[model samples]
Target chain A: MAGAGMKDRQSRMSRPKRLRKTLKIPAIFFALSLAGLIWALLVDGSSDGLAALAAGSPLMALLWALLYRRQ
Target chain B: MSANMIKRMAWVHKWTSLICTIFLLMLCLTGLPLIFHDEIDDALNPSHWVPAHPDGAMLELDRILEIALQHRPDDVPIFMSFDTDRPVVNVTTGARPDVAATAMHFASFDRTSGDLVPPPDNGAAIMDFLLQIHTDLFLGLPGMLFLGAMGLIFLAAILSGILLYAPFMRKLDFGTVRASRSPRLKWLDYHNLLGVMTAAWVLVVGGTGVINTLAIPIIDFWKHTELADLIEPHGAPPSPVALHSLDDAMAKAKAAVSDMVLQFVAFPGASFSTDHHYAIYFHGKTPLTRQMTIPALIDARDGRFAGLRPMPWYVKTLALSQPLHFGDYGGLPLKIIWAVLDLITIIVLGSGLYLWLGKGGQRMDPAMEPLWQGPE
Candidate 1:
């Protein structure tokens, strides 16, 4: 239901309004970074690669904010 | 939040960040190379030497030690550590068991042939120099404690930054870099975005770095409290007697903790061992547990098996903080990411300084200007 509502909201919601609604993506990125750090610490082998990718979410966010929309 | 609250938070954020920015910059710079510590060692010291008898049966630990002692006739072993992936045993020796770090000498011997294996590292003195400065500014405990205090102030700045972030970001979207806007806004947005994006990582590294700075005191506390208590039950230590066989004691310790791999052996009278026991330390077989170790005590006199002494909670906390702060748990990719993040942190810090020096306060929105403006 929430996902459906978010989609319905997305149809008319501007990107800034969408972002300000709940600080959704940034919060998710934060969670991912923290989890990735702990995940990398806890496991080994190829999972480390996965963990690194997860931890690099902030870097991705940085790039996205730089390249995407400009006002 | 009220204007009064925002002003107070701004004042705090300004001062705290201003104070620790230089030191934190130094930390980030030095920490970049440290993240690739293993790779650096491997690159600097290209080791082409292989085991003399790779498949042949390895020599007894006792003979290896005897050969090591014979090589350094005047010195005694302080600590013995093993190489995980190679057939090498390293013995650190000093004139006496209790000696300062500078007075100690280290040598490695191949376990199979008992031949002397030259220690790795052609030269990395500059790296060590950077690491030392990063750790304590070469002021020893005082420097460490001072850095820890700086870390505390840095965290306060982060908190204030967060409180202040909400007001600036109220209208602006998350990570909205106004690069085409005036220089100040561009930098301000840059600072905010980078700071908030890297905030989680910064907190982790900063918190763990603070914990790491308290290592000496924590270990000393453990030694005096829990470690002392553990050894007390064994009664007052007896006079010096003929030392028992190390191989036998190792065998007993192996039998005691068969699942763990040997990390090192701290002999009696050494800093890490009691005066009457050979503390054989073992780390678990798995990756995470490998960071932690438990030591089994063997009576130095008769080599009787004593119970295992697991590190207390605080020591474990320190052990775990190491990899978290180092960003070494993952591989080279993680190190590269760590370096990039660190470099971006430098920009965030540098731009913050730039913003503060200019009309940052005077240029604030009219109402908020009075709140942030200081004597320029």
Candidate 2:
């Protein structure tokens, strides 16, 4: 079927994602998150404000992702 | 990865997320209000009551215990804890020394006058009700363990989600919304983005929650093993007819752990202590060591110092796990962040359900279904 041939072409276009590329930004966010979580626990007072911001990398990434390049 | 492998991961991701989605939603909803429970309680019950004798000499600990016992004539004393910021000491009494936490009655007394500190229970009942639902669903230990199992499943769903994410976004960039695409792809993209961003926090919260559910078992293990051995040399347990002065015992316990502040005291014959000694617990005033308690035992019969012991590593792990889960350690800012992340997680869960329901065909419900099977 002509439709079957098109489906085959589309499936062929589905390439496997590069592991390094996929994990690049997520890795950075994860490291920052871990550091921030520990920092909050190890100290207190005004530093806690800093710690919360650091732990909020994901939130930052999230904001950037949603608003990065609007169509 | 092979297409089949991706399909397998998808299978795992789908079912696990589907099974635990509802419970996770419940947890997130209940957990939102609980994060600021302290603030809510404070706002609801604005206290104007002060100590009876601000400048007068302090009331003896023994006298306070006596008054507490006199107030609850039929109940036996279990725990005595002091308020960190004020001159109030809380006494917890129950029908028996080894009763469950639910059965215990907690009342605060002014250290200056031995007068009962009244808490206008304005919104406290609501918070208590939410706590019960959040903790055990009112089913006690079994319910707690059941939630713990759910937490483990949630973790599985998270990890599997992460695994499947790599292949899902193979062609697309990070944070890709694909709003112009079909509804399924847009939601799928959103779910992946939110899932990855919120993974670490949810993992930490979920893991610590599992640890917390094991509290009763952990405490029981400590009591039956370490605590029992420590009290072994003191001979068989004996119920003291007239216990020695609690003030004297407190003084001895304080001297043993001079650097740490008093946390609480477990009376003799209590589950937290032997029938021979009063287990007086203390902790550092600093944020790091605040919850890590070191207990000093004092003989109840003659008020002798019975040595100080820092809690074993397991108990310390349990202690550290508490604040991580509660998000209470780093003050208000951290709590706000925790609340935001919790909301994001709720959205992620909802979107996941939406994506599945939109599959339309019943064929998609079983394993090896969904996106990968579209034309393969």
RMSD of each: 5.2, 4.3
Interface RMSD of each: 6.8, 4.0
TM-score of chain A of each: 0.66, 0.68
The model with the greatest DockQ is 2
Candidate 2 lDDT tens digits, B203-236: 8899999999888788778877777766676765
Note the DockQ of each predicted structure: 0.32, 0.38
Clashing pairs in 1: none
In model 2, the runs with Cα more than 4 Å from the true position are A1-17, A69-71, B231-241, B362-376
- Assign candidate 2 its CAPRI class: acceptable
**Per-residue alpha-carbon lDDT of model 1 for B111-160, expressed as tens digits?**
99999997774656777787888899988789899999999899898878
What DockQ would you assign to candidate 1? 0.32
Which runs of model 1 end up more than 4 angstroms from their true locations? A1-22, B96-103, B230-242, B360-362, B365-376
Write down the TM-score of every candidate.
0.88, 0.91
The TM-score leader among the candidates is 2
